[model samples]
Target: MVVKRRFRQVFTSLKEHSRVSYAKIATIGGFCDLDLIVVKATSPDDLPLPDRYVHELLKIFSVSASSFRAFSLSFTRRFGKTHCWRVALKCLVLLHRLLRSLPDDSPFRSEILWTRSNGLLSLYPCHFLDDSSSASEDYTMFIRSYARLLDEVLDCLSIESKEAEEDEVLESLPDKMKEVGRMLEVLPQLQSIIDRVMDCRPTGASTRSFLVQSATKHIIRDSFICYTTFRKEIVMILDNLFQIPYRSSIAAFGIYKKAALQANQLSEFYDWCKFAGLCGSYEYPFIDRIPQIQVYALENFLNGMWQLTESSSSPASLLTSTMESPLSSTEDDSDKQLVIWEKVEENAFPRKLVKDEEEEPLLQWDVVDNGNWEDLLEASIGPCKASRNNLFYHSNGYGNNMGEYGQGEEANGWQMQLYNPYASNPFYQPQT
Candidate 1:
């Protein structure tokens, strides 16, 4: 009972501090302080910690988990949206570190806890963008920090000895492979977040907008490049595994095959984005847009392994086509042209109209005599026919001719003032 009360007090203190002090929430002094208390209590009794007491401590950590969850959800809410962005990101960073700090023997060392914690962290950008108050600087910083965390995690999981014998390396490969797969699952989410952040505008006008925009573009481009690098490293590790005797290499080959397939898919998606113009020139380049040569070579090597294992024509046919086709041929020039044309059409009219009006007319074709055209059209057509969807028209069809000229004693004298060809049309309109 005393232990329960003590844990309650500790939970309350940690919860209170998590809200205000970013530094304190991140340190061992925060929740880990409570962990020490629980550990010490068991020592004084000279007995193994009661399962009930340990459960109570888990419950306390659960509260910290809930706090992080609440912080993430609060980002989209109207109240404190601006202030919550930094707080929530900080909490996630701290929680990620805290989870990593748990002893190997701790109950929380399981995959479930890590997944729950990392899943919340992965959703940071989805909520971050939902908040209207988030600044570009916040997004830039969040992305950089998230990337750093991933790098650290990967660095920890990476195998050091490149020349180690297959048996020696295979012992550690399973755990390392699982970690890589888990981290790979998070890449798509990170890419999606970076894409959305790039699409977001700064909340208000500021001199930093250009810099923020540039920084975000670079971050996204660099992140994708980093993902490709990590994939290459994984493939190289798999290749080392394949160098062993055929009997031992079979299981490793299976993992390698799957990784190769996924790498192909990721590369294709990146290419689609680049060709579709979703990516900008500020970061994405025309030549060597996606680093897929390594992916292609890895894929071919896996396909050869599959041919050997299954005695199948499928892998042979796939390899033949892959070798025959140029990477650019995958996305047809006609489709690329169509996509470019569609974008041009969408931005062509109003933007062109605005620019033309600002500059002095240089050619006969450049000058548009809207006033005279309207006068001629009005003389030809009497009054605009009323339609149900027309805002100016009424159900009884009486207000179809309503305009500045139709309002007063001038109504009878006004000759249904110059019928505006653009008025009835929704697409084109001359700016007032």
Candidate 2:
């Protein structure tokens, strides 16, 4: 009796503490004999939640105080919480894509530029977090910093090699040398921030605004400028050295990657990475190895080009010459052949949220409409000519139900106007 009484008291304690409970609302398709019951369940699958909900749950858990907690966005059959591990995956996928842009022999040839850009687009639906309370505030800061890091890292990568001295000088701060482990930890949070910033309601509009905002933000923009300049410098150096700029040169020149490996920026690195995990709620390991793979592809592309330069004959035209190719008249060796384009088609990663079969892809929305504005207007028109108002009103069977009387003096005396047999619309012509 005592235990039962206690249970009842706790169940009635919503007055003292915020309570969570299940409710069975009205049935879907209720008019039919068979109804679909809409019940709010304890599971995350309640209400077919969008992916953004998961980001909030995972990010809050990153703060020290909230680390043990977990929240989830649900689907009826499957579900997951947004966690730190997602940050790791986001970095890994992006880095992998960036590196793949370099070719095998070129050392900087990337094969997945298109693929990676697509992945970036796929990273949306992660912004609905509201972790302002002290319980989850640290995680929010971590995310903000992680976004700033990505903005800077990309900047360093873009810089030309001629300003290497200046770039190095500017990068002297301890935070500039963070390690790969640290970077991995924060990727998800960065992913969350970016993912959220890029997409809002009405879909495509937010991405443009977000990009513009990022470009204008001083810290983020400066970072891009630094890397872009650094990349330009390396390209110039390589162009002078071997009459070629292999992928390896540009990939190896990153400030963050170099500093991290050197152990000088490990503290800064760890801080950012940890913060990223806190924001994204996931850790990604794959980011660390992507550069190596990209380097290999670039190396192969450059070697192939160099080998051609070494043995090619001035006697034959460059276009017709198959002599420098791995496939040869004299040899049947497979490794000698350069598989430039079609070699990796089957291995590409699948993206999230492909559109429906009949739907046209997202493009600009300023196009001509066939007709019908009155049907689209849900609100009342302040004042328009009676004829215009009559268009929609007369089309409806219960036109008078709209708070305006259609009978008596409101109906102008123009009803006796004779119909023209030669009118444009044949339906309006008088009967023969």
Candidate 3:
């Protein structure tokens, strides 16, 4: 039996190698490097991938948008053809690492978001199963669950990217309400994925290979990070409700209930993680639950919001108008004029001129024009020399500095200062 299994493994490996070679030969002109990198990175084995190949793929993916496209195509094609669970898991791992390593604003990440939003990214073809043995069956189940979790991860990342973009314009009440609704939608999806993540544990001793153990550890870590983010988002949603004066009390109560329940579930999940030994050493902060008093306050707030909504034609604008600057009102014309005068006074002198005035007392020097300047210039062929004691020099040209006419010590004293209009005003005092 052992001999037959070894022979089958060797034959499978040889076949996979042939297929890879053929692929490389086929794509020799374009994306051969990418194909080679993916093949080596996801080598058909039950061992952890080497860091070197991952680094190489990252280097290629980071090259340009074209390289990102080529790598995605090559990796997808390679994974699609693969029939072994080891290679499929490795491909998922590579993708996870790449997504995690890519910056939030990376062009490639934006590309991923666009593709995912358009339903263009097709990663499901990478699924594979080798269920001839009990151990293989266990791995197959874990891989399916892992694939689902990864899909959720990608979706989560895309949602986060979109949320980041939306946050810039999320100041309005309607936008904030929409954002809260979107976040509420994301929580249920994330909780479902978390359930899947928790289910991907080892069933028996037969499935506890080094590779499985490593993958399980990563899944646990990623799940924990996701849960942490989930908890924070829920808390944020609950807190942001108070900032908006006019909101639906029924919806707010529903959100609070969902958050409180999820909080308990997340706490239990954390306990499970600790028991599983993957996260035993790490300590997660205890998230505070929503208080009953806060819920009552939210109810009253929302009830008031309903009244305001019925009474006001534009409740959101009316609420925000309360926070506007008093000077912005048309009734405060005198205050506005005073503010304008203060601003004009502040701009009376530029910062550089103000600093120069502060550093030195203003002194007036008489401009002594020599009638022998033309005769002296006509006599001298080269640059003229001027005395260093003079603080100013007159240049014949508009833009030409004093240095062009004379390269002497007088050029060193050629301080070009701007005229400060406020300097002549006796009433003007330098701003404190």
Candidate 4:
């Protein structure tokens, strides 16, 4: 009888403070679900339950104060107290239904169940997560800095407009024009900062490993999602700014292209990491397939750009040779060999020689003596001797026959005399 009275009092208090109907409270299947909703509600002023109602509810539900307090502190610290309790209750109920859909022995099932029962805010604690708050802060800083730069650029444009009005007849502009020019000069510096921010993504192997080591897979995945969304918002802002006619110069296009490229690479890496996280394996076919997929994407982008431009020159052509080689050489070895052969065919014989059937034979072999074959062979096989006009023999003591022959004026003259095949005498000397 006493227990029934205490439950009645707790229900009445909950009805008064939370505005929940008595019929609904009575129809709740278990004390645990009621307790979860009440705890989540009590953390914020969104549903302001009186202190006495909270105490009675906890006592009736048999929930420990310490557990509720810990969960409230942790959750409020991370997400703040601005959430709507009714919406939070709905989300929790939906999440609980989803969890119940999983198999009984699933790790996620056990982990989420344990977190709920222990009054923990998340399946994985905030302490186990990476410092994503710092990254968010940095992102905010980048946005502010870029916003200021844009403002300055706008100011410069305004000043230039004013100077143009005042300098209609002047050959050169005055100090205001000079000031605007100086302000415009700082635009590149601003663009460089934007480039740095885009390139600052945490896609390195070590950073990913660190995140995996320190946090749950879901935490790391959520962090990546947050980061990617943040960057996407910034990219949208940049795209909007670039749409302004004055800012649509070639240099601005180049900066936007670079930022888009880096963002794409980061997003690809994040997607791969997320897939690896879900599959619980970062090894093997997963890692190996990333480059292939990237190359495929690059090929599509290049092809699309080529179709749009229809020009021989492409923006991608400006990439360093090393980057272009891998992208261009994605074909199989047989295909590559075929390409090489085609090139060889095109370049090897650019001009064809005309046939001359009426032309005489270049040499008459019948006049050659067949008996002198041995002598011809001996002469052809022997080392050549250097002549007097050869600079190499004059510089080096060794003749063209190498060390086998000495370098002397008399020996050279004698060799030259012996070389006169048309002379009647065996030895002949010509005037120096």
Candidate 5:
């Protein structure tokens, strides 16, 4: 009974601090080879291996395991609709659930807890963007935490400790970790799936307004350059496992092979112009605009993934705000959805640098080589272009005048769902 109560408190502490700590690692951790970023509060020498931190780490591990487990189990079946974005969401929810589980003999429950603003600005982009070292930290913390949790749970259940032992705990970590790596590798698949689904819906040419030829180019760039980075991280994680010898590596070996096959599909994006049907002549370079809506979606999806890896010390406010509301918009009455693309020729960001304001503008990036999609990824992050991803035009929170557009969630249910993950205003109060 004592253990359970203390563990409850211990977990609560973990939940609170882990939120900020995890974010730190996710953002800054990537720069340093994906190792776990242990943001020491006060000094590490002062705290040592405290009980509260142990319990919290345990919970974070269990949460990461359970979430990825679901993705692994679901992948051979139904992961496409939202696998790219959906898998990350499922992981965060599972992380929250795992932090709450506890056992009675919580030895380190009374350890000192701490927090600070330094936790932020670490810029943990998200798990997908984080590299092998940061990913390894997530793996290591998860294993250590799981070992402790498993031991405690067995004791509480009155099951023979011998029934479930140390080696078993250690063995479980690699499989769970590798599974997560595999799932994340497939994150880029979101674009292809979205494309296929939208394409399945017919478009009546008559109802279509302003069919932009450049949208295809934008999608291609996003698919290859942006999505490939995600896919590459997944491969890096899986490949890194080969360095660590474990039984789980055997299980992951097959998964790695499958991930490899999925990776092959990405090559098709190199010829995105062919698939998006953007081969026709254009007045401007059509393939370089930032797909702001899609990128925004990727950012939110990554944010949730990092939350799942965290130790659970964050408040709901930070978490809630991280889940931004979508831009509000009205739905077009047309039942047909267009698998149309947005133009990159008129990108608004980085304000095209021009020495000679000549009528025939110079291609700034000078990317005439359109043979591979990887070249597109070489183009760094810049300003956002106008979005067709969400139709802010559908009267989301717009005034009587067409110029006054608002993306308030209350004004448009559709817009709210899309923006709920990336915007910062979901927690904002609605005007009466």
Candidate 6:
């Protein structure tokens, strides 16, 4: 068996050397040799492919996005056709390294993660079997499981890359529910990847290789990334539980159940890592179970909020606000909804219909006599102080004019009051 394995290695090395030599020749003739990239990527040597090849791949990607598909096809084809375990593992490592090297904002990451043609970026199409020896078969199984985990990692990176691109827009118009939905989408993928990492560990009493040890390092690194990201997203979801919206009581309950399950699973997974003596286990933070108090509080909050929505006259319209409100306005009447302020007060912060009328209020306030500066300051800040007394002060407080406007008549445009940050005031006040 030893003789046979040596002979196979010799033959593989010769074949690889021939390909590299031909690729060098192709390069000298001013030709782009993609096969060279694939050969280097799937090299049977235990060590990682050198930095030059990675740079070459990035250069190709820089030319055009479409050119990247060609590289993907070649890399996937090599992985699919190879019978050697070392070559297959090398393919996985090479792909993993490429993903790590790419920037989070790169468009290529999504393409690599989701490309479905010819099973690119997916291992489901692989059917590897090495029956020459038990050790070889063990390596094959490890490769398969590791490949599965890499698929999940790619999935996570893709989601994050897309999110980074849309970050500005999402921040400008923040949506807590939408953000939570995305976190929900990614959290499970991290869990699955960690599970696969566990499965990729060496089988009992199986003789390991330098290649296998190298693979172990990659697995450990990936597990760390997955574990840290998993914990962070879970904690964020829990911390912001009150802000995230739910469609119904069941949805909120579902999140609570998921959080609890993930907490338990994390504890178990960490314990298993400790038992297995996996590197970096000691560095992991202590797992804290989600407190039931939080769950109960969330339950109460959801109950009150949903109850208010149900009792509203236009429950369907509650999702939106009227055009008069600063909330988004839709031109379609069917999509429009009554804002709370409109229901409570008809003339609160009324917007001037004409631009000409809008300028009149500011002009009236600016032309106040410089002689009565104390009266002017009093007039500006006094009515606004009334706003701090009540949480929901919506009445138009301008029944008496302070400047040029006639007495006993309300101001024509919006009403604004001055605030002294130095003075004591309620923690929250209306802004308009």
* Residue-level lDDT tens digits of model 4 in 1-432: 667655654553453345334323644755443435444433322332334434443454244434434433433332222122222222232233333333333343333334445554332221221122223333323223322322232333344445566555554745543333333333444434334333334333423333222222322333343344434443433333212222222233344344445555555655655564532444212211223333223332222111111123333432211122212233342211100001112113111112331122211222122333223223322344544222121122234343233344432331211111112212222223
Summed backbone clashes in each candidate are 0, 73, 0, 0, 31, 0
Name the better of 2 and 6 by lDDT. 6
Model 1 ranges off by over 4 Å: 1-83, 99-432
Worst 10 residues of 2 by lDDT: 70-79
**TM-score per model over all chains:** 0.27, 0.19, 0.55, 0.19, 0.20, 0.56
lDDT (tens digit, per residue) of candidate 6 on 1-432? 778787765665676666657776777787776777777556665676567888888888787777666767777777776766777877887777788887866776656654753355457544775433336668778778877877777766767767777777667545765576577667766666766776677664332466666667667766666667777776666544434433322343555556666667767766765675555665666565876544433433232222111222343443321112111112332322212222223424322123232212112233233333334334433334233322222134334444322234334433332223224222213333
lDDT of 2: 0.27
Write down the RMSD of candidate 5 (Cα, Å).
28.7
- For candidate 2, lDDT tens digit of each residue in 51-104? 332343234333433222111111111111122212222232223233333223
Candidate lDDT (C-alpha), each: 0.35, 0.27, 0.54, 0.32, 0.30, 0.55
Comparing 3 and 6 on lDDT, the stronger one:
6
Which stretches of candidate 6 lie above 4 Å from their native place? 1-32, 63-66, 117-121, 131-134, 157-174, 204-207, 246-432
Query: What is candidate 5's TM-score against the reference?
Result: 0.20
Off by over 4 Å in 2: 1-215, 236-334, 337-432
Report the Cα lDDT for residue 371, model 2: 24
Which of the predicted structures, 1 or 5, would earn the higher TM-score when compared with the native? 1
Each model's Cα RMSD = 26.9, 30.7, 24.3, 28.7, 28.7, 14.3
Which runs of model 3 end up more than 4 angstroms from their true locations?
Answer: 1-13, 17-32, 113-127, 131-134, 164-193, 202-207, 242-252, 283-432
Question: What's the distance in Å from true for residue 344, model 2?
Answer: 39
- Residue 64's lDDT within candidate 5 is 64
What lDDT does candidate 5 reach at residue 423?
32
Weakest ten-residue segment in model 5 by summed lDDT: 108-117
Q: Ranking under lDDT, best-scoring first?
A: 6, 3, 1, 4, 5, 2
